[model samples]
Every structure is written in C-alpha cells, then in structure tokens.
Target: MHRTPTRRQIQAKLSTMPPQRSQATAYLNAYKMMLEKERLEEELDKLEVRRHQIQQRLAILNSQTIPEGDMTHQQANTNLEDNTPKFKTLTLEY
Candidate 1:
C-alpha cells in the first residue's frame, strides 16, 4: 500500500530541493535580462521620435518659395535630346 503526500508535506519537500533554488535564480536572471532589453528598446524609440521631430522642424525652416505663372523655375527641366550629355544647368538663370 502507497500513501499520497499532503500539500504541507509536498511544500516541505520542495523547500529543501536545490534544483528549485537554481530554477528560481534562472527565472530571475531571465526577467532582469528581459527588463533591460525593454528599457533599451524604449530609449531607442524615444531617440527615433526626437530625430523625426528635429527633421520636420528643419524641413519647415528650410522651406523654399514657389513662383507662380509661366516660370520654369518651379519645375525641373531636363533635356529631351538623346545625344546631349546631362548637365547641372538651372531651370531659371538668375
């Protein structure tokens, strides 16, 4: 005949186990690593958002004025001649 251990007996047995201590330590280390990774990712996201905001601000500051009516300056002009070499000529010569 075999007897089943009670809940208190099982708890007492678990308290003396070395493997349980090691398992707890491993779980703690894994949790710490996960937290550190999450913190770093959050920092990276903040930096990326700041960078995007700076880029938008810079674009607004560096905005150019567009001229109205019959002026080629507002549009890019490319030579359609196949034999002509590409040059860095401005659409409107100031």
Candidate 2:
C-alpha cells in the first residue's frame, strides 16, 4: 500500500541528498510544500464551515423562547440537554 511521507522523513531525505542538483531538489521541495499548504487550506475551510454551522445553531438556540412558569431548574436543564443538537466533527490525521 502507498503511504504518505511524514515531514521528518522528507526533511531527512532532503538533508542527505547530494547537493549538486540543487535546482531539482528545490523543485521537488516546492511541490511538497505546495501540497502541505493545500492540505492546510482545506482544513481551514472545513473549520470555517464548522464554525459557521455552530454559529447558526447558537443563533437558533438563542432565538428560542421559553414559556414563563414556575418551573424547577432540573426541568429546564433536562429540556435544554434533550433539545440541543449534536454535530459530527472533522477528524484530521497525518
């Protein structure tokens, strides 16, 4: 199976490379850096989306009105806990 290379492995390989062909090495390193940048940008996008979604949920929750009555704290807590929505989150791994 093909596995992704770790930053440490890439750095070690680059360090031990023969320094004469610097141009080729630079191009290859640039490509790897670009890939890493793209991956981070994608993660940032996912985080932005998740943030927006959470904000929307919070707005909805804040706008909700509760009936006024002599209710106990336990009942209100239960209602809040039961009605709150659970969301799936992004899992990032190298």
Tell me the tens digit of each residue's lDDT in model 2 across 1-94: 9898766533322456555667887898888889888887999999999999999998877666333233456688888889756786889999
Q: How displaced is residue 38 in candidate 2, in Å? A: 0.4
Candidate RMSDs in order: 19.6, 19.0
What overall lDDT goes with each candidate model?
A: 0.64, 0.74
Using lDDT as the measure, which candidate wins?
Answer: 2
Tens-digit lDDT track of model 1 for 1-94: 8798665521211224354457878896677679777887999999999999999987776563223332454343433335576677668766
Q: Please report the candidate that would top TM-score against the real structure.
A: 2
Model 1, residue 72: what's the lDDT?
54
